[model samples]
Target: MSAGFSMHIFFTRFPLESQFGGAEVQTLSLMEGLKERGHHVAFLGSCPVLLEKCFALSVPYFDLNIGPPPVTKWHAISFLWRQFLMRKKLINAINEQPVTRNEQRVIFMLSLSEKLLLTTWAAQNKIPVFWIEHDSIGRWLRWNPWLPKLRRLSRLATTVAVSDMSKRMYLDLGWNPENTVVIPNGIDLRKFYKRQKILRSTTFHIGCVARLSPEKGVDILIKAVKNIPNIHLTIVGTGRDENCIRKLLEQSTLETHSNDEGQVYHLSPTTSVTILPSVPDIVSFYHSLDLFILPSRDHDPCPLAPIEAMACGIPTIMTDACGTAQYVENGKEAIVVPAGNTEVLHEAIKQTTLRTYEAASVQNTFSFERMIDRYELLFAHSAKL
Candidate 1:
């Protein structure tokens, strides 16, 4: 096994044709990094968009037409039947290239069933398999009846967690700690660079890029900014709670105006809350903000938003629930607050607005080169086994 070994990366839920998120970006960047390091990298998935992107990058890719998982009983049965067909397609794709024993490896980020199927195939063929866990342990691993079988299959593969928190969760869920590796997600510094800090505007612009969902705590952000003067919040991305969040904002505005008691609230007419659907110009979105916030209520495994903001030279306020908070100092790189505490978040926002921080202090820690080097080490080690 060497640094130039061939790697086959597999992801079942790659949403290439639709809106891509942090996970997609991380995966693509990793592939590019490996390619740049002179390794032969190939992607195997069902996403047409992914295939298209791979083609554009001149990377080898195979499409298995593995659409979204089945939701109904009838569809589940059909999916099982199609699974057999997909297995054949996958085998043929892998067999297309014959390499030395230590020159081939499989990297998978897949659903439980797909993982089990592929790992079994890999093991039978004496190929090393690595599983990257992008999420914390959840009911899927705890309550599923396939746990015993999945655990057995997992023993034959190396598991890579995205963060230390995620690794701990897997260990708590009975995954073998020795076989699990923690690899933090990295950002492409070239795509997100620090811009010249602009002078303060008449109204401060606080922006967030996240799905409008309960777990993301966008409502908490809205509530925190309600009475704050001259601070406008821009929320980007759409989700199931879009309508609900809009209604909450509208009602809050109505209530505030009605209770003004003939006194001006100090909130400027243009100082408003804006919700945007997903946009392609995310780098521009980060560059337009005076500050960025990630008010997650749930334990986000490893959020890329704050890191991206840091790279853009925008100070960020992220809740303690974000795993990336480990890399940030309270008053240095970012303002870390307790999750779900609106009052604390409000105060943190006010405090951060009074100060400026250096993005270079934290940007180097999450560079794509460092992340790639670590992955290369892990892959090379796995290949030797």
Candidate 2:
């Protein structure tokens, strides 16, 4: 088993299948990188509209949905049950010996179902299974009934966590820290290149590219924008909270209020706030804005949007809870603020509007090429074993 050896990796979701936050981007980029290296790659899963839009022109991968229809959400009582059934299908695939690798090193993306199947098959066949954990264990262990199974899989497979925080949490939860690898998500520098000249905009635009979910703290940014004068906010991404955000903004504007402390909590209907639909061309959106902000309220493994914005030579303001905050230096590359603090977010946005900075200085450390090289090394090593 070596670098040139033919290996097949199974993805639970095609990188182009869903509009995922950071995990999907990283996984899809890795798949593309591996394909570029001439590895025989196959994707196995379904995708939603967001992913379809993002990767519409991407290379085609294998999709299992061509067979009989998969289990529906209406039939499954819990998320865990659906996951269990999906893995059962994959387990059958392995038992049937559909795909084969001479020096088998199986990699499983974020699918817990695939993780279990690979672990079980690996234990029986002496094949190595690598489990890529994209989210925090703390977040999943709370409601998921599969923690015990995850622990078992962790012991059998090489667990790859995207951030140090996520890896530490897994270790705290009694996972074998030795088998875990912390591979921080990297930005795709080629795609996210900064524009030579900033796009001319009528207003000082503060933009964010994130799922409109509560954890992302889009509302916090909205509240912060209320304090900044003459600043317009553009939020990208859609989620379950989209309706809630629309309602909140609509109601806030209708409330007649002056600039008192309560005014921050209450929105005057007269305020100018624009909510735009998600766009396929995020690069253009990042370039069109004067500044980028990440106002996440909860801990995230690592976010690629802030790093990508910085790569495009756009300065960013990210909250402390963002795992990628480690890459930013205050007053140099980006402005770091505490999560859920509207005042800090407001001041950060205000300061960015008044600053003149060079994006090249901050974009050196994050690049897609560098990330691909790291994965190539990891995959090579895995195949050798």
Candidate 3:
């Protein structure tokens, strides 16, 4: 399905993050594809990292500068006042450069607050609200209850989930089945293609790209790595658990060494682990890995890193609990294992041989073009309503 008419799409995020994740990557991809297709697209965001990204891509964006989340009752009132001011500013910003009457307007948001806050204004202007939810249920966001009911009362025109597993989770959380739909996170295969490994390291190499948060299970992966006798593990990305991961490394019998590739810690003569906060060239990281793994213990709604690795024809291992599990077949695209199982993870890591994967099939299945097409259809339908 495709939108026959051009749209003026406004993408949004609330409680924005400093470190980029799959959602940010997917948003940029959608914006790029839509811009290429001649749609007028803009980002309404506060995050510095994302705003700079929009600037680099030459995509227009409006910054509704944000403040910290409230930690107390009085702070909550202050936060609400700040949001009120932001909403007023947001309204004025949109009014200044309004879309042409012919192009349909769509507010594509990533949070429930966007819908609840903008409902009356959106309805008055004939702009349909589309919630593209990325987080799974039972995350830190669900700490409260009364606000969820309010969000339901202000139910959006459409809700887009990143995977079937994600869709199901929201369905249980009282999302309208008629309005909810699934769109798997997509990748640009040209950027993440397979390459021949020219240089080789003697040790078996395993790599994982994830935020070092509790839900991501980086600690579990570390425990599994400790058991493996002969291995080299590279953990990429940064989050709250950096110091904890370092401590885990130090507490173990691993020997630390300073290197050009950042810090390298050796568990033994046959085992070494390198932890890099960020990689300058990500495609090179994928190409360098012998095996890629996403050991998410609780929930992950269709992450793009493993898909990028699969696009590079690397054998993958991911837990069954995450939304990314639905995309790959067992022993084919990736090795699907039970979540948080150290022994199983250790056993899976033991099989160091790469599998025969058809990267072309992965490219065809999860291309950003197809993802945009699905979104176009969804937006087109909302416009018709």
Among the numbered candidates, top lDDT falls to: 3
Give the residue spans of candidate 3 off by over 4 A.
66-83, 150-154, 197-200, 359-361
Tell me the tens digit of each residue's lDDT in model 3 across 67-182: 54343345445655676876676677667767897888877876544555566688777788777877656633445433475347436567788888888877777778988888
Question: Residues 66-133, candidate 1, lDDT per residue (tens digit)?
Answer: 55444334544565567676667667766776555545656565445456557788888877777777
For all predictions, the C-alpha RMSD in Å is 5.1, 5.8, 2.4
User: TM-score: which is higher, 1 or 2?
Assistant: 1
Order the candidates by TM-score, highest first — what do you get?
3, 1, 2
- The superposed Cα distance between candidate 3 and the true structure at residue 63, in angstroms, equals 1.6
TM-score of each: 0.84, 0.82, 0.92
Alpha carbon lDDT of each predicted model: 0.72, 0.66, 0.77
Clashes of each: 0, 6, 0
Model 2 C-alpha lDDT versus the unseen true structure: 0.66
**Least accurate stretch of 10 residues (summed lDDT) in model 3?**
67-76
Model 2 / residue 240 / CA error / Å: 0.2
Off by over 4 Å in 1: 1-18, 67-89, 96-102, 254-271, 359-364
